[model samples]
Each structure stands twice: as structure tokens, then as C-alpha cells.
Target: MSNIHVYSEIGKLKKVLLHRPGNEIDGVIPQTMPRHLFDDIPWKKGAQREHDCFADILRKEGAEVVYIEDLFRKSFSQKGSREGFIKKFLDKHGIFNPHLREQLEAYLLCLSPEEMADKIMSGIKKSDLGPKKQEDFSRFFPEEEYEHYYTEPLANLYYTRDPGASIGRGMSFHCMEKLGRNLETVVWQHIFEHHPDFAKDAPMWLSNESHFGIEGGDIAVFSKDVIGIGCGLRTRPEAIEQLAGNILPQDTFKKILVFTIPKDRKFMHLDTVLTMIDHDKFTIHPGIEATLNVFEISLGGSGELVYKDQTDKVEKVLTKALNLDSVQVLRCADGSFIDSEREQWNDGTNTLAIAPGTVVTYSRNEVTNELLRRSGIKVLEMPCGELSRGRGGPRCMSMPLVREDI
Candidate 1:
């Protein structure tokens, strides 16, 4: 087996990828908060502190923690990696004019690999691209478009799980639905294709170069052969079905459970509304307790897929998926209507299970975290005063890269 296996959500995490809030936060303008996918801005320094504590806890638990910035730095250290990345990065943002692209490349290439990576994440100013030539051409409509940057900083890159996911021995590099997040996956593609530690072990099962949108936060492995994906705001149902196309032929994964949740940003991705905590236990927001749409998909004979409508009650479907007689669905905020709503909005249910029955959650979600503890689960709390502003909890911040199959 490769070092990238993640056959189940509650597997023992051996290694994970995280991004510490960096200059991207500094580049966030009030005008761009919505574009950045942030309801409110995070205090970068405090968010960093909290992120450090999060990584420290994982390291203390024996999980090797890899970081985004470090990976990009290493990946760009190859002979012509920086120059190649600059061309693609500029071209992606619609800087098609030859002279403009050359100036942008020159500006970016002036930095070392480390600074080049950071600069791209932090964003380059419009003035930094140099004055546009008279012959510059663009498809952007005159009044409706153009900005200070050919490409804006990917502020949401810190939420590492949204770009891609690890499925058993393979990884799905997502095509993010939001333009603000698209380049984030580009950075991941480069690292996945070039980074020494990940290149060999993590095979690309899907890439955004040509595919529908699927975010890592919406994907969870139920077992080697069974997996669950959220058809949420950021993930399209077509994407999940297409992903099924990529995996169903292999013996490693045979079934996919697609949970179609509301398109509202509050329940943005699956992890925000539900998370697996144990072999037969889950933490879910009361808001989605009774109304989630479920569908079962599996490979049929002769390269066809079979589909079936599933029970609306997630607990019933999960029991069957995990082969358990019954599964426990614990409500966030302990069944209180108002508190549950508030905590769910605060990502109280978005817990990260590092191992069975153990999870990392935000300390501010006191009501929900307390309830998780009373249910015989070990809830490790991390400060999130600033981090929560991004509308994600622990699970949204980390992506498991190596896990021991339970």
C-alpha cells in the first residue's frame, strides 16, 4: 500500500497537509470579502497562533504535519519550475498580451522560489504588472471587468481541504466552483506533480484541467469500497458522478453515497454539516438531521452505473453503508434548537477525527463541544476566535494525506 491511503474518515491520521494563514489574509480587501469566501476577515497573527496550536496537537498525536507554503517552495526549486509556473499563472488570469505577460514574468521571476510562491499567494498589485502596452488585448467587457490584479490572491487557500482530496492511493485535484479558489488548486497540481514526498505516492485520480467541480471538504471515505460525498454549494452532483466514473472501475472503491445538501453557504460543504466520528457514529447539525437527500451509486456490469434512491434519514443510510445494525447520529448543540442553529453556523459540527472517537473542534463552540464530550467522545478544543471568521472549523483546515486504514 502507498503512504496516501485514506479508506475511512476516522482512520489513524499519519500525515496531513495544512496551510498557515499567510500574506493572503493581508491582501483581502473589504470589497473582496465575498469573493474571498469569508464572511469576516481573520486576524492573521491570531489565526496563525491558533493554526500553530492545531498543527502542534496533530504532531503531538504522532501525525506528521506537512504545510502548503513549504510544499510550493520545494516544488518550485526544480530547474525551470518557477519560470513555467509564472507563465501559467499569468496566462490563467487572462494576461494574454505578450508584453504584459513578459513584464509579469520578469517581476515574479525576480523573487527566489520561496518569495515567488509567497508573492503569488499574497497577490501582485496592478501597478506591479507594469503599464499595459497599447496593443494589450482582453476578452473582459469594458465596464464590467478589470481589476488591480491580473489574478487576485487566493485568500481561501488556507482552507486546504477545498482544493483536492485523498482517496485511498489516489488524489482528486478539484476544479473549484469559485474563481477565487481556482488558482489554489493550480498550486496543488504543481506540488502533486513535482514535490518529491507526494509525487510518487499520490496518484492523480482526477484533475481540474478537465472535469467537474469537487472539493475535498465534501468528500469522505466510508471504507475502501464505500465513500460518501456531498453535493453541496461548492461541489456539483455532476462532479461526484464523474468522480464515480473514475473510481468505480477499480477494485478499491465500488460504492459512492451522494448527499445532496442545501446550496446555501451556511451549509457550504459536507464537513460543515456532518462529520464521521467513529465506526458507527456521526456528528451532524440539527438543521440537516431530517432533510438531507441521499443517493446510492455503484458500478454495474459492462461499464455502466446503477443508482438507487436512499433513505432521507442519514442515520439509516449510514448504518447500511458501514454494515452496522444501527448508527448513532449525535446532534450538535445537544438537541437545543436555537443553540444548535447558532453553533452549526459557527462550525460546531465540523470536527476533524484524527482517530476513532477522537476529534479536534473549535473551543468557542462550547455547547456543541460539551455535548460531544458527554457522548463519550474525546473532543480536543483549539482556539478559533480569528480562524472561525473564515467559516470553517478544524476539519476544513487540514487534509489527510497519509492514514492507516482501520
Candidate 2:
């Protein structure tokens, strides 16, 4: 059995799951960006090409990359799993159309893995509901609401980092407040519970049932003893409390650092602000490190509460709390106002460390990329002009399952 407990940022990555952008990017119209938690829609073809390059880099690094669609199809193939999932979806959405359910099930069963994934993520259009009935069906069900009632499928499943999170052998799924994103969470639950490749007799923690909302983008493992959580638009404070209570005691982690992000569209997740690069050093946005607040959370004899106020600059607090004599905070852009502000808005600081001092980022953020290169870090840049238009970066593209702790 592989070690499922991921303890550090600099750890050697073994296996990770990534979803390359699909047709869903084309469906994200400009009008729906804010509602769908996106800034702008990207060109689908370009996004896919960039994501493919990112996947190739990870593959070259010898990390096992699992595609979300492939895993979902594998889970669907298991006896009773697809039916059970359909039932759950129906119950959750209050869809009682027996005929529709039967038809949908039959259609789903016939699809290939890639087709199923695309339809499930991008969704089948309501116009594809076939010919209308001749009879006045309204009288049979007076309360029936039928305009575009067929499931408006989740289009952001490619940003696999937003649905759930895992660390140190424990996993917790996010309870999506928006109904559009719920299907992705449902798929995540199915994968963790039934996928033979990952289940491995591992215990699971669900955030949906607990009323604690958290996303993978907001969670980061700095070291075995340290974790950084971002509290902002997506992740709530209660979720952090729940996470600390559940995971800390099991691994005996010394601290969980909480970084409070700006409650705006630009700074959506923690990854937008800080990401580790090497031992005792990190890439950061000055606004996040200098302007935002930080809190130290720990479980004492009574319960979870503030262990210390770390609102000082993130670098200063990190050095003091971790007891490191020196810590380097590389600016996301050279200390210039326009470059820093512009790049940070596009998630420039968000880089996923493949290994110690090695990371991947969006090539479009030239200033941030240059900064990283100057720091002696190997930067594998992927052209994310189309991808970044959707308001996520490299950190939002992948979910790490296992990494060795520093």
C-alpha cells in the first residue's frame, strides 16, 4: 500500500489527478461568468492545448496523472454504482420523472468514458429532450416546473481542485453552495468511495454532510507539521475548524496556518496568494502577505481556537511560528504596482510544486514567471491565456493525492 498521508509541500509527488479543459470552456458564456464563479470564458481549444502541455510536464516528472473522466467511467462500470449514484442525484434534485430517469440511465450506460465525461461536465442541452408530448401533461402534475429542467450539467469539472481536498491520508469534499457545482462533488464522492485505484481501504471525511465548506485550492500542505489554509469566497471559517479537529490529532501536526484572503473575485483561493518554492522560501503576492490577515489555529485541551495572531506579514509570522531563522518571500512581480496587481488578479502566484524548488505555472504571467526563474526555481510554464480567462491557474488545475513529507 502506498502512503496516503501527504505531509509537506516539498515532498516527492507520487500520484495526482488532473482534468484537462473540455468542451465546458466553450459553454461558459460571458453572461454566466460571475454566477459560475469565473471571470471570463476561455477559447476551448487553446485551453485544452495548454492543459495537455501541463499534463505532459507532470508525466515527464514521473508523477502518476489520473484523469477525472477516466476515473468517473471506471467507477460507473462497477455494479450498482451508477444506479446508486443516479438515485442519489435524483433524490437531491427532487427529480421524480421515472420515464426520464430510465431514459437518462440508458443513455449514460451506452456512452464511452470520454463522451460520458464531456456530457456530464458540459451537460446535454435541454433542446435535446426530444419531441414534446401531444397531451397536456400540465394537468397531471400542476406544480411541475418545466422550462429548462433537464440537469444543467456542471461545466467547471475541469477545475478539479475546487470540489474536494486530501492530505495525509484523509480526504474531505466541499459542500458546493451553488447547485451547478454539486455534480462535481457527487463525482468526487463516487471516486473516493468506489474507485479501486484510490480506495485502498482508506477512510474518508465528507464536508457536504458536515456543513463545512472547503475546496482543494484553499488547502496546502507546507510540511508534515505545517499546513496553510485560505479562508475567503469559497472556504468558510467553520470548515477550517472542522479540518483542524479531524486531521491534526491523527498526524500530530504542530500547526495549521490560516491565511485570510480578500473576499473578492480576484483573490478567490489561498493558492492565489502564497505557494512554496523551496525549503524556507515561498513565492507570494505582497498584497496577500502584507495586506491580508493570518491566524494560527491549534487544538488545545478545550477545543479549537486561535493559538496566536499571525496578522503580521506572512513571511515574518512564518519564520516566527516555524522557528526558522531566515525565510525568503519572493514577490510575485518585481516591487512594481501595476505588474503585481495585474498578475495577482490572474492568479500568477499560484504554482503547484512538482518537487522541491520545481513548479508549474501559467506562461502568460511573464512578470511572475521571470521572478520565479530569478529565484533559481525551475519553472515549467504552460500557455494559459485561455485557461486563465476562466479565473484559475496551475494550482487550480491539479489535485495531489500522495506526496512525501519533508
Candidate 3:
């Protein structure tokens, strides 16, 4: 077993990993971007610039900003690693079209690590081929329209936080539920297993498998010894069980807290309702703090059992389990009716902490951000009009591997 570190959201981070938006945006047709869970198809170059700014912020703060593509390239350069990765991908997807598979393998091998990672994440363009070849290719396989079809790209790859969740000694790279998004997990596994910078130092556990599905967005590391898991559309109850089973035996974590939010499209994960700000302070929607039912599950000699006799409001439960006094709750504007509905639907409550008392959020959530700012929390704004179209906010875009002040 590797040394797994308990994450309390305030741990001093030495390094952080991020995936910047790539040409994958080009693969998303403007009409379908939202349904695929994106708002507007971002201009690749502009998105890159915006992402650079975010990276610069971290770099300026003295955290190492590791790029996903660089790690992917390093993994692909290793012979045994590349072959193992390609084999696993093809076998899992059941792609047996010999000639097509061979062609893709060759193309993949020819690409630099960055290009290969981009290709795997975004997909290769079919229309880029010459006209005569296109016509001949169409005829060669009547059923298949082009020489190669775009693998449904991992359009959500930029949201690294969804797959990287903290567990013992290291973090778990969650397997995605959506088949189209599976490639991102595959890439993560490759990087964790083969990337020189990460392979030796970073330990990873798999939470998503054929039978269980989990997403990182649904899990929150509230304290070094406590984890808050959100159960809803993206993560199954079984997945939660699997996580508890694997993590409980580890000495670092002492309790697993379960918060069941209404399974609405907007409340996709816990962060959608709750986020940690300063120590002992949290920003949450009133409904979640006051009404949601929270259960504390402890590991028993055999397995695990929920304390059926005791159930409490999320705030009280969290406060007791994590050993805190009071959690400062900030209500989004219009906490009564129409405005709350509109704001929550727009991901107004989802914010990511850069450091204690400092965070990033969507500027569009003016009332909510203002409330947070008035509370003495520094609110850094991202150009979210285009970003929000995808149904997630700042929290969704970032995947923090290390935070420096836990």
C-alpha cells in the first residue's frame, strides 16, 4: 500500500494538474454542445488564453501547474506503456475492425504525446482528407461514411475535478459513467501508471469499474478524516459503497458522510450546493443546509452500516462529524422562490477554492457572488457567459491535485 494523504481542502499543495481546453471544442457542433453538456462551443484559441490565465494564477501562487498533454506524451513514449494502453482501450470498447484498428494504432503511434492525448480526447477529423480518397474511402466501406469516424470526443475533459478525488496516500481517478467520456479515464490511468513525474509519487485508486460508476464531482474532502459524498444522477449508491469499502480500512480517513440532494439536473453534485470557504465556514444553498437528510456511515468489523437511529440536517451532521462549531451558510439571492430556481439552474453556488478565504466563481451569479464577497471572501471572476452554457461553473473547470494550506 502507498502512503495516502487525507485531504482537508486546506492542505498545502506542492503541485496541481490541469487540462486546458483543446481542439476538442471544434468537434462539438454548435447545435449539440449544450445537450452534450456544454453551453457555447468555445473558440479554441481564446479558451486556451483564458485557461493560461488560470494557470498563471496558480503559478504565481507558487503551485506547480502540470499540463495533461505533457504527461500523456511521456506515457506514450514508453514502449510497454503505450502498447498496454492501446490494447486496453481497444479491448474494452470491442473495436475489432482489423484494418481500421490498425490504421488508428499507427496514427496514434505517430502522434506526439500531446497530439495523441488531444486525439484521444477530442477525436480526429474525417473531413480533413483529400477528395478522391474520401470518395474511395466511402465506397470501400459502404456502411461506414468516412475513413475514420470521430470517437465521441471527451468534451468534458477540461473538468478534471470530476475524476480526481482525494483518498488515502493519493487520489482516486474515477471512471466516468458516460461511455463518450471513458477515454478521459483511460488517459488518466496511463498518466498515473507511466508518467515519470506522477507515477512514482502519486498513487491512484480506481472507483469506476464495469459494475460501479463514480464521478469526482460527487465526492468532497471536507476534512482530512472526513469525506462528503453526493448521491444523485451521475454517481450510484453502489459506487458510494465501493468507495467506503476501499477507503475505510485506511488509517487516514475516519468517517464517510453521505448527503442526498434532490436528484435534479442542476444539482448534479455536492459542490453544486456546498463548497468550503475559510476554515469552519462553508457557502451553501439554504435548502441543502436546512432540509437535506445526511447520514453517517461507519465501517464495522465486517463491512459498513448506516446509523439508522440517527439522522440530522446536513449542517448539524457535518458539524458534529467533522468536529466544527458552526458552518457559516450564505443563501443565494431569492432563496424564497423564482430567483433561487433560476440561480441554482445556472450553477450559481458552484465555486472552487484557490486558498482559504479566496475563490473563483462565475460573474453572472452577481447576487450570489456579492453575498460571498460581502462575507469577506475574495471572489475572482471567470468569463462564464460562454462557460456556463455547458451547465457547470468554475468548480467544474478545475481539478485541484494539491492545495497548499489545508
Candidate 4:
């Protein structure tokens, strides 16, 4: 009955959170692609169509899909929530000038809560504020600063998994590694703090206020008592230690498996290279097998922190952690290194499991999809010609809110 109840990756999903691609996707032009964390600009309509298909698959499987924007709007339904949200938004992202801050606040407050929520996510351009004489900003910014056109857009928001993750009856709000994505968690913070349905009971495992970087994509719950966190480009060891300290002693969790992966954009997060598809089976990109290092964290008998450096292979690590007799490591593209590299770049290993042996992935990764099917997994594929432009697949775009314990 809890709002957040994800216990395992392959559980029967009951509810999930997603964000439809909006004008935010359109804001990614060539000049801003790197800053926005996109490799290419996605066609807005095509991206929306793809995202819709992704949602449709979840619905067909009996999972209730909720949009981040809708949840955010509901969070502001109270009398003064909108005003408070707008102030927080401006304080972190608005211009420093008092006059401009007042103008932006007035503009945002005039809109309905739903419209304001969309506007904030879509971003505010200087042009939206009407023509300001150069003199107006001359005192606040140098001549070179004028080249920056607008407030940073939440372009990466559609990959809703990075902002926060749903653990067992609780959620871990992240401090995203990049400036463009960090604000995304603020939206989640607002929803979890003010939305009546969620705010009433859901517990928070980690707060976004942490100085160290951590992302939802890097955290995966394997079972009720086990969690695997990737310490790589987007997640820091300090944050992982902090999360383990907070979660291990109090929750059902007994051990936190920490994977130190290659810190490269190509291997951005653990989910991008590895994900549990079934109780004893995992889908992994072969590219990372050579560089991956594993560790374990748990609480001692006296509630003191305990750490162990793992020496077994990744498969062995999982087998012992989950108490399984054996584990299957399904290589992406069935071990075709060249093909695996290409497909992994397109998120071949990022599969979202709605139930044991059932997953949703990008249709473009034909080799990987076929491999999953050959391994007795039900693979549902979604069109991702546009969605893949963002370099994420099904799992990266979804955050399971509730799942029946496996």
C-alpha cells in the first residue's frame, strides 16, 4: 500500500514514473548538445511518439504509468505551493537582478499550476521576458555573457530514472553529476514533499542536498535484502558510502554491492552496461567485463559499517549476494565485441523488466533483443530511432514506483 515499493528489478511492476518528451527536447541545438548531455538533437514529434509507445507497453502489462509533469502539477495544487516552488526555481536558476527576479516570478505566478510546471521544465528564454535594452543587463553581465540565451532547460528530464530512484517503500533523490541535470531532482523533491498522495507517507532514503554526485541510473535494487550501486562517471564512492550508512542499518537491506566501472561517457551508468533481467540472469555489455571491480558494504552486529573488497567475477558476486546456486550472464550481441560496442552505445543492455523474464528494450538493438529471446526472456521492443538520440533506453527512461515482491 506504500507509494514507493520497488524490491527487485524483475518484480511484477505495479506503477512506474515517466516523463514525455516536451519542448525541452527541442531546446537541444548543436551548439548546446554537449552541455545538455545529448549527442544529437531529437525530432520532437518523433521522440514523443516513441515515448508514448514505451508507456503503452507498460500499460499493456498492467502497470500504471504516471508522468513527472502531472505529479509536479499536483504537488502545487495547494494554495501557496506554486509560489514557494517558483521562488525556489528562481533562486537556483534565475537571474541575479532583483528586477528580473520579480518579473520572472510575476510571470510564472500568473499562469495556472499546470502551465507553470510545463514552463519551468521547458525553460525560459530572455526573449520570453520581452525585449530588454542592453543597458538593463549591462550592469549584471559582461558583454560575453550575453551569448547565453536562456535558463538551462531540463533536456535530459525524459530519462526520468536519473533524477531519483524508488527503493523498498522509499526513494533516493539524487544530486545529478552535471549542472543541466541536477535541477531535475528538485522537481522530484517538490513532488515527494508536497504531492498529497506521495507526500503523506513515502520515506526518503537519500536527499538531493548531498554534495557528492549520485544518480538513479547508477542504483539498482536486486532483491529485498540486496542492492547494487555503480560508482562511475555519474556516482561517487562517498555518496555510495553515505547511502549505505543510511540504508543498511535501518532497512531490510543486508548488503550493498558496489561496482566500480570505467568512468567513460560510453559507460555512463551501471544500467547502461548491466541490468538484472531475471532472478538468476543478467544482461551485460561485454565491454565492461574487463574493467569492472566489485565491493560489498553492510552493517556489522553492532550497527557499525563493514566493508569487503570482492575478488570473485561479477557473476560470482551476484550468485553469492542473491544466494543463487548459479547465475547467467547474458552478453549483449551474444559476445560479438564489435556489434556489442555499437549496440551498447544505443543502450542495448538497458532493459526494463516488468516481471521476471519479461523486459522492454529499444527495437534498434536487434542482436541484443534476439539474444534475450533465445535465452527464454520475453523481449518487448519499442521504436527508438528518436528516443535513442538521447543515449538511453527503456530502463533509463522509467522509474518503477511499485512492484510486487518477487
The candidate that wins on TM-score is 4
- Which regions of candidate 1 deviate over 4 angstroms? 134-147
Candidate 3 local distance difference test against the native? 0.68
Candidate ranking under TM-score, highest first, comes to: 4, 1, 2, 3
| Model 4: per-residue Cα lDDT over 87-193, one tens digit each | 66665563677767777887788888888888889887776777554556554554443334456788999998998999888888888877668778888888999
Error of 2 at 240 (Å): 1.1
Local distance difference test, per candidate? 0.84, 0.75, 0.68, 0.88
Winner by TM-score between candidate 4 and candidate 1: 4
Runs off by more than 4 Å, candidate 2 = 1-3, 91-118, 131-149, 302-307
lDDT of 1 by residue, 1-406 (tens): 5757788899889999999998788767667788887888678899899999999999988899989899998897578888777766665566676766777788888888888888889888777766666566643333233456666887888798889888888888888877768888889888888888777856677887755788988998888878889997888878887888887786488799999898899889999988999888899988885569899999888788889999557888888787889988899998899999899888998999999999999998899888888888998899988888888889999999888888
Q: Is candidate 3 or 4 superior in lDDT?
A: 4
Q: What overall lDDT, based on C-alpha atoms, would model 1 receive against the true structure?
A: 0.84
Best lDDT goes to which candidate?
Answer: 4
* lDDT score at residue 181, model 4, on the 0-100 scale: 87
Ranking by lDDT: 4, 1, 2, 3
State the weakest 10-residue window (summed lDDT) of model 4. 141-150
TM-score computed on alpha carbons, candidate 1: 0.94
Q: Look at candidate 1 and tell me the lDDT of residue 23.
A: 78
Assess the local accuracy of residue 196 in candidate 3 as a C-alpha lDDT between 0 and 100.
69
Per-model TM-score versus the true fold:
0.94, 0.89, 0.87, 0.96
